[model samples]
Target: MTNTAATEIDDTSSAFTPNLTIDVGGAPMLYRRTGRSSHTVPPLVLLQHFRGNLDYWDPLLLDTLAADRDVITVDLHGVGGSGGQTPDNVSDMTRNAIAFITALGLTEIDLLGFSLGGHIAQEIALVRPRLLRRLVLAGTAPQGAPDLHRWSEDVYRWATGDVTAPEDFISLFFSGSDDGRQRAWEYLARTHTRQQDRDPESSLACRDAQFQALMTWGIPESAKLQRLSAITQPTLVANGDNDTMMYTKNSQLLAENIGGAQLRIYPDAGHGFLDQYPVQFGQHVRQFLGC
Candidate 1:
């Protein structure tokens, strides 16, 4: 009687799938896939922000993009289901990104990297130029300088493990204090942690690990910020005007160097505006991918 019903696979279809594995960094890479149809255009991959898990991405963005093309959202090493491999160095993260793509059998795809993930995106484009079509770098920078500003005192403390849970300090992450700030914070906090995602301590440890590695992570070519011109892919350096983590100039600099890169800045947002400005950002990405 237990075996009365014949076992069947999901031969029908799915609008979205979750937690698929790929081998990267000698660990199973856990990423989520959602799409309207699998046989259409090259897929869109959403790279999570610093110390962020894939669950925090705006569902509106995911749903809209998925309706037109396949979308992959992944957690980086030392985060979420990617096995939390503590990164001793920056190259490991880059290698992890490349490996995830290879494991997915993605030949050329659109990469949308947010905050910390943007750094990884740039690394991939630099090392394996053939693998990328268009790149979107949001609220990110190429290198880190110890002397530069930390997002906030609380953020600096958290990055150093001097504290956990930088609580309300994230208020600085948005310029929309009255309406947008409350709305963004609500979404961020609600989606910030998912039970299925990595626990807070592990995520914190991963954050600490990257902090040490990135302190000295240097892009000599991009130091003089010269060789950005050498990357042959069409790039989009998008940001919010009020992102204190890094200025809008970083976007401008990236655009200027990456041969005809398009720059877009949301006038009323901050670091994570990719979620807040999903439609505009998604449209911009659509155009870039169309190109």
Candidate 2:
């Protein structure tokens, strides 16, 4: 459906159950919109982690956030139900995301991005500072972040493994602690809640392209690293204390580099720390966005 105007259909009964689609630059982009619509505050647009689709979001977290503010979750180009080939780099991803937002007739939005999506969100804020009201980066790193290159091999190994297996998710997202493993299972359960109209699994090509973008982002030569100072949006940086995927120190770096940014680190968690502590995380996000 080619909808240039922002179309909002109310699913008041259950915000977590709706799966909607709109045309973004002539391609179908699948998304879910929930939460209380506000005239004063711009909607919170979420960008998912590597290989994650709109359905991959934790329903408890989405529902909790939606209780007060409008929450939007989308599938990036060529991932899940979105149509088009995946871009090979973060720059194009940022452009496409901007197009998606503009196509929805939104002039301002608050962005929350996780891992690879955080990288894209950073680019978006840098490229068009006027488009954002606030920014939240979770389980992510800045470009040219120290020791960023070390995680690539482990990421590749896990991504190439059986993605549908619970074990793989545990290995990739959580720490070795029993609590972490239990939270991983809960998070995985939430991901499977949308049994109908579910998005397709990310293709190998898309995964490879995302990996390439990630590697490029970690390179010191990438000019985007030097331009982070341009992102003046009120930002929140969050991650697990033991995040092996992106490393926790990067969150601190993000907070330090981005003027006035806040930082949060959850203990005994890994990359999916937000998912691990959905209630506390949701409260923090609500407080940040509300303030």
Candidate 3:
């Protein structure tokens, strides 16, 4: 963990830094920007997991990444504080994300995407190759990977249920061991630190649409893996060794397919390894971005 004292003194650090909105195609996108903007370093734009909003991010992880450069997080359209109905497919979602970036007047950025967000990030790289300087894919898989067309019954129940309990999240994201559960509780507490002005919880519509997109992306087609060859940006692929949601093997597949991409798999962790190993992952990301 980063020193709390240092984070407190830095005005632009932490996840509680303030929510701001920008209009993209007449709809609003809720977002937060942390750390001072740098001319030399492209801002790190974060894309969230399935059903995640701005408040879903871990404060400690955000602060650690914000130590040296700007970090940005946004709610997907029709989710949380953002306006407009959610897109039901990856292509529309990719366009929505691209609109948000261009609306910010940024031509170049470093993208860090998790789960469903990682899928969209790949689309962005392929569609707008010049817009990204680097890419970080965590707990995600390439399109059409086998055994991903639909999640197992247990995961589907917790993930798409109308309400998600603490136990559900812990079971879905963290390892079953004692230490992993301890870290899961800590991560949950940190996310709830923001007392006011927090982004609203994700809606049912958002959940349904995102799950449909995931299912569509997971339909098996070996040729879809070939699409990754066009993503030539410096890439970092990482995940927990026990990711029940996306599965650990997907992360390995990503590293093997993307040319020159580096891979990291943290042991005794699950889908939420970035939060479980926040400090180490943050350091790795900072080093990769070269800020």
The number of the candidate with the highest TM-score is 3
Better of 1 and 2 by TM-score: 2
Candidate 1 steric clashes = 1
In order, how many clashes per candidate? Answer: 1, 1, 0
lDDT (10s digit) by residue, model 1, range 1-291: 121111211222221244677767577767888875455467778777656666667655665566578788887776766774767565788887777888888898888888677777887888889888778888876664222334467445533444434344344456656755655655554343233433333366777776765555533334546646567888889988877665566777777778878788888787767766665677777777772
Best by lDDT: 3
Itemize residue pairs with steric clashes in candidate 2.
Answer: 35-66
Residue 126 C-alpha lDDT in model 1: 86
TM-score of each candidate? 0.81, 0.91, 0.95
Candidate-wise lDDT, in order = 0.66, 0.81, 0.89
Cα RMSD (angstroms) for every candidate in the order listed: 7.5, 6.2, 2.7
Residue 84 miss distance in model 3 (angstroms):
0.3
How good is model 3 by TM-score? 0.95
Worst 10 contiguous positions by lDDT, candidate 3: 1-10
